[model samples]
Target: MSSYPPSVPPQSSAQQASQPTGLRQRLADLRGPAVPPRPLDARALAALAANPGCGRRALLDGAGVDKTVLAEALGSPAPFGQSQFAIVRGNSFEAKVKSDGGAELLRLVHAHLDPGGEAPGPDARVPDLSAAGPEGRAARTALALREATAAGAWTLLDHPMLALEVAGTPAYLEPDAVVVHPDGRWTVVEIKSFPMIDGAADAAKVGAAARQAAVYVLALERTAGKLPGARAGHTVLLVCPKDFSNLPTASPVDVRRERAVTRRQLERLTRVEELAAALPAGLGFGPERTAEERAAAVAAVEAAYAPECLAACELAFHCREKARAADEVTALGRSVRGELGALTTVEGALAAAAGPGAAEDPTAAALYRAALLRAEALEPVG
Candidate 1:
């Protein structure tokens, strides 16, 4: 399978302008341009920034930015500064965590693949008994172990200790179960009530879960980073249900997959560490009036919530409170290069409107082409 996951491309402004034939279409999407984002309370901001992606949730939840201001900031066309850039970067890396088919397959292999495990027995019907909470998790663990022992191909680990922590962050692990295989290796199991989806539980949703498992793997490694007495390899297994109903069937996650995904994404984590190094930890974007010069940096954003700023904000109800006072219709504001800016600016709030793939808009996704045409008209780069 291809190692890289799929991604969506960004849209351009110029291509959007040509789409709308009517004036009203442009009036609807006026939030393309606005003042720079304000200073933020990083913690409050993640809630606003939260998406379905798990990694985005974990990392942003760690940083403490203000959601309202960040929401306002994202609506603007300006490129993000280093701090904002770092936060957005975190969202990308974290988006990769989640559980998938591989995890589900592992669970089946663990139970049925054993040497002489009993016939599905009394619990043959349950698709995932592991998600049954303490009683279920414990019972499932015991039954699975007995089957493993009979099969001879499997072995159950006892109270194996596991922990997942990065160099500077706290370990937020509460491993529900751990098992050792006949291969002398071990597996950690995380049971979930939700049905399994592709990459839904892997680093895609619980990206940190892999890192968390890595920490446990590290802990198992005991400083040398290797598990002693046990086999040379151990994996973190994520156990989840196979379907939405009360099916006893469950799935198992492979640790190696977690390791592979985390290694790539961990590179994206440095910005968080770098920014944390540069600024005081408890920085707040709003209410910085106590310091004279500091307040100037965010004055425009701090003074009022510009109508454009709140266009896509989840806090629309909050923004609507201020909509009555100002011209919310012009959220995109004047273009930066004026004409050049206009070409690349958000077209929704203009005389014409364009959305991503809005081939009907004033421009197709061809704002860059328009910009290029203009740039080409300018004197050579010499």
Candidate 2:
């Protein structure tokens, strides 16, 4: 804040900047669907940066950007954009606990468990460090300095916010632990006192860490703007204790990974927009549709494919709900899809309805086929 981004000034420049270039780029994006994307926060940016492969899917989910639209944006080779996600599942939580904060003493535990949220130890051990306090300010500056020396990351002691806007917002990122891997690229590292669990970073509690790091990346990129010396990569450093009371240790995770994931997500979500665009006059995703219309849509998805739900997927709940509510067999998770009896796709229904002796099945498939046939037959021959 002291250097780059200038801290969104609580005063004058706010008017000149007109919503800070950083926020503008993030806020101005109007690509995908009828759905307005949620404003980009540090959380959203961090997510995209973390994903580089399949993590691209989360970008759409995290940003609330439609998936089909995102898929289109990505077009061919992945990672045009991205999102954040939890990488490991199996006991990463316990592993994190074992590796963080040595202060795992029961007293510390009781302090958290205790009705009154008081620190178990005297206040001296855990100081109230803030930029305003002499000790806090000194510690913060020192930590910032230490972070740069150790990481080889691009450190802006106090960068200025003069970069052009992307998506309309100024790119003012403040990087402390910008690790330029052997690849000679720039990575922004954040030192956190939190513990790491290979869990969803986008979840409410952990999302903040990623988001904060992302904002710094944005600010730094904006301020540094394509300098020949500028490194093209990005990341976040999450520092946590190996034991409850132990001093924290840090790990650098790629922000690019998250971004890659998010981009794919956006691409897929855009399909809803496509559907809306091609839909007949009044058709929509709204509940106003009659049961038949809803059933028809559901059947359409079910006919073509079944998707397997996975433990690592961020949208398990969403998939489950849609699968349950609409009988979208395709929405079922792959692991259990076969067991659950959902292997068929929408095409199967139509095929069955048009087969040599097509009247046996009375399901939605036959009805839909009949509707199409009736509509087509109704057209007078030219």
Task: Please give, for residues 1-382, the per-residue lDDT of candidate 1 as tens digits.
Answer: 0011211112222212322433212211111122221111211222222221223222222332333444354342323233554445433322222223123334454663333543222222212333332323334544544455344343433222222233222222224344445544445554444345543534443443444454445344432233233532444555444454333344344556644444444433433333233333333333332333222222222122333333333333333343333534323332322343334433433323223444344444355455556667996777
lDDT accuracy of residue 172 in candidate 1: 22
* lDDT values, one for every candidate: 0.35, 0.37
Best by TM-score, which number? 1
Estimate candidate 1's alpha-carbon lDDT, on a 0 to 1 scale: 0.35
Q: What is the lDDT of residue 174 in candidate 2?
A: 31
Q: What lDDT tens digits, residue by residue, belong to model 2 across residues 1-382?
A: 1111223222222222445454323322322223444333343344433332222233233224343333222231123222222223212432333222223321323332222533333211211223532223333544544444345432333211222232322222233333322222444544333444542232443445554555555545543353444444465545444345433344545555444444443333322223223324432222334545533432333222224223223333444555556655455444344432322444544455455354454554455567678879999999
Q: What TM-score does candidate 2 get on C-alpha atoms?
A: 0.35
> How many clashes in candidate 1?
57
TM-score of each: 0.36, 0.35
Each candidate structure's count of clashing pairs? 57, 96
